[model samples]
Target: MDVSWAAFVGVVVLAYLIPGPDFVVILRSATRGWRTGVAAALGAQTGLCVHVALAVGGLSLVLSRHPDLLTAIRTAGGLYLLYLAGRLVLATFRSAPGPDREEPAPGHGDRSAFGQALFTNLLNPKAVLFFAAVLPEFVGGPAPTWAQVSILGALDVLLGLVAWSVVILAGARLGRLLSRDRVRRWWDRTTGATLGVLGGGLLLARD
Candidate 1:
């Protein structure tokens, strides 16, 4: 195979290292607990698997060829991001009636966090396009195109998992430091604003 495994690994490492929605979700979930963070990470990986399947099936090319379809995906993704942002913002305003000493109810169940992470990754058009563009670069090699793409896609997921694991662990450490009610409030607001901006950016994105 003509594929440069080293280069591919380097690129995947860089991509996941850059902070994005997936990173944010994993960090936030980790703040709640490691279990939630793991769930969110797994969920994101599951979404990546979906994209890999699409790439292997050649649907990524089809979407690229059809701008309208890509636009549709972008719009749906943007709306979902906006929805999540709104929820975060609203959560910041909500006051728990109980004392601060009482631990806040768990923010989200594992299933809920998983679903959120899955949808967040799946809705991201950039991820789809990334796979579409990059997978082909390694495809013309001696090994079958499908096999190469699958292997590369799996590598992508593996890199993402490793990167997110670090993010989760670090966030968990930070979460402990910021567990106080006042600090937690500010953290929520910051994350909410970040999500809002990302969603708005996605909405304005042009193909």
Candidate 2:
């Protein structure tokens, strides 16, 4: 696989534009608080990196060998999305206060956020499929597979982090315009609905 800088950048751009769990989580977190948003972003990226590693290491090979398991994973991922969506929608009607409803109340307890982000991404089997399918496109035969995967993994983390950070920063800015409670409620509902739609979409997807 020959490495073209332009092609690589294009792939990254496209991935950024593609709507998925990472984007939804980042937007939700950022609007809530920078710490949570960054945490979720880093967490999701960590998961992506892990999936890339697994793909390069040929864990996907095992998965491929077991089509039933793969299907189960896909199903689970879809269900998880639905569950998250339901949670969000339920929260929309609740008087409860979650991270989203909170203010810019400062404190960079980013470790927790990072862990949550990482867990969400890691648990997402769709991300695993994504790495299996998309990661190989960037590599050439002469290049060490691990080396190519490493580069791609690094790119995934960097691009994903940067993209989510920008989103969060922008949300933070917009956050100042609305009352904390209103912003929180609006984002919660929006995220809940978005997650629901995404979940349903995922269920309907085939690949």
Candidate 3:
């Protein structure tokens, strides 16, 4: 294909760099341990794969053509974000060991985190729209549209993984700081507020 490799890479890199719910989720998981952090990142990427599949199979086009379907997805996504926010806020009030206590080793939490991150990405209508709007830009080269789109989608996933790995690793380094009960409580409230704001923004978003 005659894709603009440099341009595509630059755009994708910049997009991944912009922190969002995905970043928040990964960062929060990182506070638990490397395994949870990686699981969260993988789950998010896996959700992106679903979007890519939908885009490739023309499902995204169908959704784009049907405003109702798009609206439904967006509403669900927004509500889910609100639910997540509520959970985070509630976490701040839950009883837990003091910060000085030894941190628990990561376990089943990683599995649930993977699912949470996966659904978080999947429910995001913006991500679906992103694939629909941006993938086509690189589809008119030597290769067929499907092939080009597939390649671009793969690249997006790869870059996303790489970018999130950095976030997870860096956040892991700060795990000790985050483990502090006071700091953790503050972080939970802050993140909860951020999620609530984002949910509200998405709920009011227009097509």
- Compare the candidates by TM-score and give the number of the best one: 1
Model 2, range 54-89, lDDT digits (tens) per residue? 877976577778767666666666677677777666
Q: RMSD of each candidate? A: 1.8, 4.0, 2.6
Question: Judged by lDDT against the true structure, how good is candidate 1?
Answer: 0.82
Count of residue pairs whose backbone atoms collide, per candidate = 0, 8, 0
Per-residue lDDT tens digits for candidate 3, residues 54-148, read 88888657866886887887888889889888887876676676557643322228897798789889988878878888778777856777777
Rank order (by lDDT, best first): 1, 3, 2
The deviation in Å at residue 50 for candidate 1 is: 0.3
Model 2 has a clash total of 8
Residue pairs of candidate 2 with colliding backbone atoms:
1-139, 1-140, 1-141, 39-113, 39-114, 43-117, 43-118, 44-117
lDDT of each: 0.82, 0.69, 0.82
TM-score of 1: 0.93
TM-score of 2: 0.81
Tell me the TM-score of each prediction against the true structure.
0.93, 0.81, 0.91
